[model samples]
Target: MAGGARASSSSARREVAFRRATEADAYELARRMFLSGERVDMQALATELGISRATLHRWVQTREALLDRVLGDLADEYFTRARRAATGAPDDVIVAVAEGVARATIASGAISGFVRREPELALRLMLRDDASVRRVLVGRLRGVLQDVLPDEAEGLEGFAAATVQLGLLLVWPTLVAGDEPSGERVAEICRALLAGARAGELSGGR
Candidate 1:
């Protein structure tokens, strides 16, 4: 029974790897089709994968679902790797977070570009309360602020974190200017907001 269990585990790993390989191929073809400014035809992708369209349909189900899988997975990978790449110094966490987010925003051009190509999808995803981007922002960013504002204990840090994430969308051009976005500027404003909030210095508040 022990030997059988080990064999089953090994076989499971192999099957996982093979399934990932197949998905990678399909993802690659979809990306290329998306990049070419042509509609992603799952049928062509299935042909490339040596599977029928119905089989591809069984695998990914729909074009939107496949695109969602590809883009969402890419975001996760980028966030994971970039977060580790951060220097993680006490004072510099804000800067690291900003750069990390900037990288993500730029990397998300793939999805954003796709959104531009299809207005209806753009309206669905980018406009009118996108739960996807919100979830993505809140997930990775919780850590960045948690590390950055240790002094502002009692969840002030969490507020700052939320502000930073949402602020990027609200005032993006000013917040992130050119190749070298002003992480310092963002940090300064965030720090000030936190400080002011604590001291009851804000003008339009309860």
Candidate 2:
């Protein structure tokens, strides 16, 4: 009985270790796949990771789920860096940040590749209401606008919503029509939205 108990305990420990290792391994590989501008092939990923397809599925559940988490993480990193680098007056800061986002998008081979390879999926994930990627971007951008537009606090939410719409408009061509993203266009649209928001605030919150 004593020997049996020891074996069972050892087995449990090994199982726990395997689960942890699997989680880390899956996340790292998926992130690398995303950064390389390659669509993740589940079977190929499993082979590359030296794990069975069942094991990869067990770790990430579904390919869409994995993509969502990876994209969310990437957006968080980009938005965090942009916010950190932001400076100057509120309007200038937001315009600068928007420009940063545009530049990053235009430069990211991963993003462009993903769009080119999976246009439908990319559009759905980027534009769908329930998508974690869109939610993360909108939430981050909204928080920044809210913090900077103190005078227009009451209308900040509306302003943020509109700003996100503008973003969608600017990026729509790239995601849908496979056109190259334009940083200048992003800057122009964002500047117009900010100016409009500020004007509305000046005009008694209209």
Write candidate 1's Cα lDDT for 65-171 as tens digits: 77665555555565677577777564455446545655565544444456555646543442233434445654666566556555654444344444444445533
Q: Name the runs in model 2 displaced over 4 angstroms.
A: 1-20, 198-206
Clashing pairs in 2: none
- List model 2 lDDT by residue over 122-202, tens digit each: 777766666676677778777787788866666555555566556766785565686776877877888887677667742
Instruction: Please name the candidate that would achieve the greatest TM-score relative to the true structure.
Output: 2
Strongest candidate by lDDT: 2
What's the lDDT for all of these models? Answer: 0.53, 0.70
Worst 10 residues of 1 by lDDT: 171-180
For each candidate, what TM-score against the reference?
0.55, 0.77
- Listed per model in order, the count of residue pairs whose N, CA or C atoms clash below 3 Å is 0, 0
